[model samples]
Target: MSEDLQETGAGDRPGPVTATATPTVTDTTAATGRAYGGADPVPAASTAHVAGAGRALRGAATGGGRARRAMGRGRGRHRRTGRVTATDDRPATFRDVFGVAEYRALFGAAVLSWVGDYFAKVAVAFLVFSNTGSVLLSAIGFAISYLPWVAGGPVLAALAERYPYRRVMIICDVARMVMVGLMALPATPLPVLLLLLLGASLLTPPFQAARSAMVAQLLTGDRYVVGLSFQNMAGQSAQVAGYALGGVVAAIDPHAALVINAATYAASTLLLWRGVRPRPLPVVHTERRSLLRETFDGLGFVFGHRVMRPTAMVVFSVVGIIIVPEGLAAAWAPSFGGGSQVTGLLMAAPPIGAVLGAVVTRMTGPERRLRLLRPLLLAAPLLLVPVLAAPPFAVAFALVLLAAAAVNTVLVPLNGLFVQMLPNAYRARAFGIMQGGIQLTHAVAVLVAGALAERLPVPLVIGAWAVCGLLLMAVSVTTWPSRQVIAEEVARAAELNRAPEPEAPAPMPARPPVPAQPAMPARQPVPAQQVLPVPAQHAASQPVTT
Candidate 1:
C-alpha cells in the first residue's frame, strides 16, 4: 500500500508496500466471535456497545462519522482487560481464498495491472530522458507519478465510495488505458506524454482504494491474511520483473513497452468487467457530503485515532527503513567489493526478504505474531545498524534480508487489523490516507538517503538511517495496542459476523414481562469524521507499504 506503494526508478517503495494481512486465529481472538471454523461464545453482554470492537461493523452503514467514533474506542483503555476465548489453529490456505470466484478475477486483474504499471514506470522514465537527454526531467517524471497519492489520495479514494467499487476500478482502468495508449503513440511530445502519464497515475489512488475495499469484502478471517500474502508475493515479484523487463524493452523501444502497458489495462478491464460480479456502492451520493469534507473526516480518523496513529507511524518507519537499501544499491554496491552483479543482487534482497516475511507471517499464528511484535519491531531496524562497518556483500545482503523480513512479519497482521476495526464506509478513504502516508514517507526516506549518500559514505548513511529508524521504532512500540485490546477486536468481529442469519420478525414477544438485561455504559462518541495521513496499517490490503 506486498501488497506496494509504487515509486518509479529505484524500485524501492514498499507496498505492504500495499497488501494488508489479517491476524491468524487464536482462542483469545476467538472469544470475541470466531467468525469461522467453530462456535462463537455468546457474551453475557450486549457487545453492540462494546467500545470500537463492539460497535464497529454495526456502525459501518451509519456513516464515516459514526465509524470514526466507533474506531476511536480503544484509546487509553489498554490498561483494562476484555473477555477472550475460542480455538481454530488451522491456517486458511491460498486454495481456500482463491476458491472464491471474484477474488480470482480481482487477482488476475491486479496482477496484470501491477506488471504493466511497473514496466511503464521504467519505460517512461527512459523515454523522458531519451527525448530530452535531461536526467532532471527524467527524475521529475518519476516524481510526478507519485503526486496523485500525495496531493489527492484521500479525495480520489473518497470518490470511490460514491459508486460501486467495481465500477470505480473499471472506469479508472479504462481511463488509464486510453491515456497510456496515447502516450505510446510514436512522436508524442514529452510534455503531452507526461500529462497523459499524470492522468493515468491519478487514477491509482481511487482504483487501489476500490480494490482494497473489495478485498476486505471478499476475504475474511485468516483467509484475508492469506490473500494478502499472495498479494505481497505477486507485487514484489512484479516489481523485479517489471523493472528488468522495462529496461530491456525500453532499450529496444520505449513506445513498445508503453503499448504493452496499455494492453494490460485493456485486458484488466475485460477481466474486471466480465469476471467480477458488481456490488452496490458503499456510500451513496446522498449520504456523502463534499469530497473535501469526506477526505478531511477520513484523515482525522486515520491519523488522529489513538491506535492507528502510532501503529501507522511504526508501519511507515519499517517500510521506510527496508526500502533504503534498494534505492542506494547503485552507489552502495561497490562497498561489497563484488562484481557488477552486486547491484542487482543487493537490489533484489529486500523484495525477496519481503516475500519471505509474508510467507512466514501467514504460517505464524496470531499469538506468536503478537509475541514476536515488539522484539521483531526493534530487530527490523537494529539488524541494519551494523551496515556502517561496510561488511561484505554476503553480510550486507543477509542483514538486509533479515531486516526486511522482520518488517513484513509485523506488518501483514497489522494490515488486516486495520480492516477488522474500521467500519466498511470509511475503508476506501482509510486506504487513501495510508497510501499517501507510505508514498510520502518512502519519497522522503529515499530522498534523504540519496542526499546523505552524496555527502557521506554509503555505508555510513545507511547505518545512520537505520539507527534513526531504530530510535523511531522504539518510540512506535510504546504506541502499540495491548494484547487485551486486540482480543476485544477479534471477539467483536466474530460477534458481528455471526449476526444471526437475518431472522423473521418473531410473533410479538409473548412474554413481555421478562425484564431486559442491564447493559454496559455507552461510550461518548468522539467528534466524528476525521481521517489522517496513513498513520500506519494500510489499505485494508491497502494500507500504506503498507
Candidate 2:
C-alpha cells in the first residue's frame, strides 16, 4: 500500500535501467495472476454516473492531492491509512530524459524509423496508383503496412521476450533495411515488391515492442513517464513531418523515397548496434510452450488481472471514443460551413492536440500524475460529451483538442503505473497487446462512427460514443483494485524486475516465481491500514473499516 501510494518525483528511481532482458522465474499464479488479491467487478454507475461527471469537471484544475482525495471520498470508503509522501514535486525535463546516451540513440532511431515508415506508405501508394491505376489497389497497398500488426503483432512481439531487446531491435531493423533495399530495385515485379513490403511490415511489431518494453530499463520511475511524453510528442511530430515529406519526395520520385526509407532503417540498425548495450534475456523458459499459446497467456494475464483489465478497458474505450471526432471531422466540417482549409484544420486537430498534450503531461510532476490518474481517466471522455450540442467549428475544434489533451494527460503516468506493476517477463507482450488494441480500436471506432453518421447527425453520434466511454470508465473506477492490492503488486513487480541478469537466456518463464512479501499469499490478504507503513502517531492506533 505504501509503495503504491508512495509518490515518485524526479530523481527518485535509482540506477541505470536499460531494458528487462534477463531471464527470471515468475511467481504469478493462474488463479490471481498477481501478488495482490482482487475484489468483485463493479457494476454500472448510479448517482449521475458518480455525481454528474459534469460536477467532477468543475474541480479539474484543483491540486491533485486535494482533487483525488475529494474524488476518493465520493467513491466507496476505501481506507487511506498509508499516507502519500511526495519527494521533489518537479517534473522531469527533456534534458533529463535525453541526458543518457542510450536514450538519445533510441530517440534518434525511433524518430527516423517512424519517418521512414510513413514515407514508405506514401511511396507504396504512389507506386500502385501509377502502375495499376486503381484507387482501391493503391489504398490496399498503403494499408498493407498495418496488416501484420492487426494479424499477428502479439505473436511477433512475444519473440522479443526470447532474446535481448537490443538484438531484437537490431535484427528487425536490418531485415527491414534489406527488404526495403530490395524494393528499391526497378527490376522487381509489382507483386514481388508488394510481398517484400508485407515481409518488412511483419517485422515492425517486434521491433517496436522491443523498443517500448526496454524503455523502463533506459530511464527509471518518473523519468520513464517523462521519457514516454517525449516519445509521444516526437512520434506525433514525425507523423506530420513524414507525411508531408513523403508527399513531396514520393511525388518527385517514388523509388528515391524507397531508397531513403531503406537508408533510414540502415541508420537505425547502426545506432542500435553501436549505442544500445545488450543484456541477457529477462525470463528463462522452464517449459517450451508454443509461441501462440504464450501469446494467449499474455492476453489472459492482461484481461484477467484486476488492475490491468479495467485500465485496459478504460484505455481502449477512451481511444475509441476520442477517434470518433477525428473520423467525423470531414462529415462534421460541412455542417458548420467550413471551407476546404477549415476542414483540413479540423482534421489536423487530433495530432495537434496530442502533441500539445504530451508537452503538458511532460511538465506535470509525478505525484500529481498519480493523484490525478483516476480523475483524468474519467475526465478524458467526459470532455468529449459536449459535442452533442452541435457547436460552431471553433468550439468543436477546441473541444476535440481539450479532450485529446486530457487523454494524453491520463496516459503518461498511467503507463508508469503499468511499468511498476508488470513483471519483466510480461512487459513486451503486454505492450504489443496495448499497441495492437490502440490501432484496432481506432479502426473500429472510425468505422462505427462513419456508419452512424449516415443515419444521424455527426455530433449526436460522436456525443453518444463519448457517453459510452464515460460510463465504461465509471465502471472501471468502481471496480478498481484497492490501494493495498495495488501497492503490494507494485512492490512485488519492482522486486522481481530488479533481479540481476543472468548469462545465456530462454524465451520466457510461463510463470515467474513469486517473490516473498508480507502477507502476499492468496489465503492471507493484508489489512488496509497494515498494508505498509504509517505515521508514527497513527501506527499505535486501532484500525476502523467502513
Candidate 3:
C-alpha cells in the first residue's frame, strides 16, 4: 500500500520544494468536504467511488512506472535554451550585508573579539621575548595561530558543514571565549597559554565558513560582493586597530591584555547568538563519509571547475605576492629609521587601498570593468617597485598606499567574478578552499621573504619580490579566461539568480448539468463530497525556477 504523507502547516507550504514526478495527494479536508459549505450530506458509496477515481486519475497522469524518470523533454528543452528571466528585484545595497541588524551585531562583536585576539598575541610575544630573551621564541608565539590552518584546516572546517551555520558560529565563539578565559587566569604556564591559543585557532576555519555562508544567504545578488568587501575592510581595519591597541595595552600589563582578548570572545558569542538568524543544516546523504575525502572534494570543486580553478589559483598567487611585502614591512621600515608605527602603516596601507579600490570598483561596476582585469593584473605588481626606491618615510608610505589601491582594484573585482562563477551550493566550501589556498601561499611567501630579509637589505629583498610578483601577474593574465568564457560565466550566474515564470492555473472543466428529474415525491439524497481532478497539462507545465 502507498503511504500517506504528513501535512505541514500553511507558512511552511509557501516556499516551493524540489518536485518529483509522482506525488501523493493528501487533502483529507477536501475529501470529507469539511472545508466546503458542508451542510449537504453525501452517500458513503458516492464518496468512496470519488476517492478511488481520483487516485486512479492521479496515477495515470504521473505516468505509472515512469515516475522515477527525469523531468520531461519540455523542461529539458527549456533548460537547454537557458532563457531565465530575472524576477526578484531586491535592490542592491552595501548595507544589506553590512547594515543588517544581525550582521551589525556580529560586526561589533568581531571588532571587540579581533582586537582582543591581537592584544593577546602582542602580550604573548612580549612575554615570550622577555622570558627567554630570544626573538625566535617571540616569533614562535606570534606564529602559533598560523599553524592550525596549515595543519588542521580541513578537519576543523568540516564541522561547519555538518552543523547549523549559526550554531557553529556561536559555539566556536563560545569555545574561544572559554579557552582565552582559562589562559588569562593568573600564573598560567607559557606552554599552557600556547596550547589554549592553538585550540582557539583551530576553531577559526569553521567559524569563518559559517559566517561566510550566512553572508551569502542574507545578501542576494550583487550585494554579496559589497558584503564581502565590507568584511575585507573590517578584517583589515580590525588587525590594524587591534595590533596598535594591543601594543599599548600589553605595555601596561600582559595579563590584562590577555583578559581583554578573552572578553572579546565572550562578547562575540553573545552578539552572534542574538544578531544572526538561525539557518538549517546543509543536507548530507551519508554520515559515514570521510572528512579527508570531503575536504578533497571541496578542493576539487575549486580547482577542477573551469572558471573556479583559474580564479582560485590567481587569488592564491596574488595574496602570496602581496604578503611578501607585508611580511617584510617590519624589517623594511627600520631601514628608513622608522619604528613599529611605520610598520603598522605599511601593513595597513594595502587594506586601506583595498577599501578605496572596492568602492571605486563598485562604482565602475563588475560587468563593465571585468575586461580591464588583464591590464590591472599586469599593472599591480609593476606599481609596487616604486616603494623600493628607498624614498623618505612619507613618500614611501604614499607609494605603498598607491600600490595597494592598484592591487585591490584588481582584487575586489576578481573576487566578485569568482563568486559569480561558483555554484550556490558550493559557495562556502569553495570559499574555504580559496581561503586555505591563500593562507598556505601566504605562509610560504612569508617564510621565503623572512629568509631573504635575514640575508639581504630589506629594500633589495622587497624590490626582488616585486619583480617576482610582476612575473606572477603576467602568469595570471596569460591564464585569464577569454571574453567568451567570461560572458558565458556571467550568463550562467544570471541564470542561477533568475526566477522561473509561474504556471497559469488549469482551465476549469465544464460541469455536466444535473438533469431535472421528474417531480420526485421521494427526496433524493445530495452527494456529500466531490473530488476535483487536477489537470495533467498544468501539472506538467510547473517550472523549476532556481
For lDDT, the strongest prediction is: 2
Query: Mind giving the per-residue lDDT tens digits that candidate 1 earns over 1-546?
Result: 100101000000011101133333333233223221123333222112244455666777878778767755522122234322112234567898889999999999999999999778988899889878999999888778889987887798888888899999999999999999999999788899999999999999999999988988887656777788779888999988888898899899999999999999999999999999988864444565899998999988878765466667777888999888888999997776765699889888889988998888678644455446667888998999999898887889999999988987777766866665565567788988888888888888898999999989999999999999888877666545543454454444434333234767868857567788899899755555644346455635554321
Alpha-carbon lDDT of model 1: 0.73
RMSD of each: 22.2, 21.7, 20.5
Name the candidate that leads on TM-score.
Answer: 2
lDDT of 3 by residue, 1-546 (tens): 000011100000011112332111112111211111223122111222334455555556777544223222112112232211121112235655566677687667667767887888998898888778999989999989777778767556766787788898889988888888888787878889889989988888888776766665565444655566666777777887888889998898888888898888888888887787776754444554777887887777777777667777777766776777778888888877879888888887777877776665555432333434566665666766766676677776666666666667666655655655555555566666666777888888998889988988877777778888888767656555543454344445434434456999999999999999887598655555643344777655663322
lDDT score of residue 417 within candidate 2: 57
Better of 1 and 3 by lDDT: 1
**TM-score of every candidate relative to the true structure:** 0.75, 0.76, 0.71
Ranking by TM-score: 2, 1, 3
Ranking by lDDT: 2, 1, 3
Tens digit of per-residue lDDT, candidate 2, span 420-516? 5677889899999988888888888998889999999998998888888988877766666665455455445656767666878766868978888
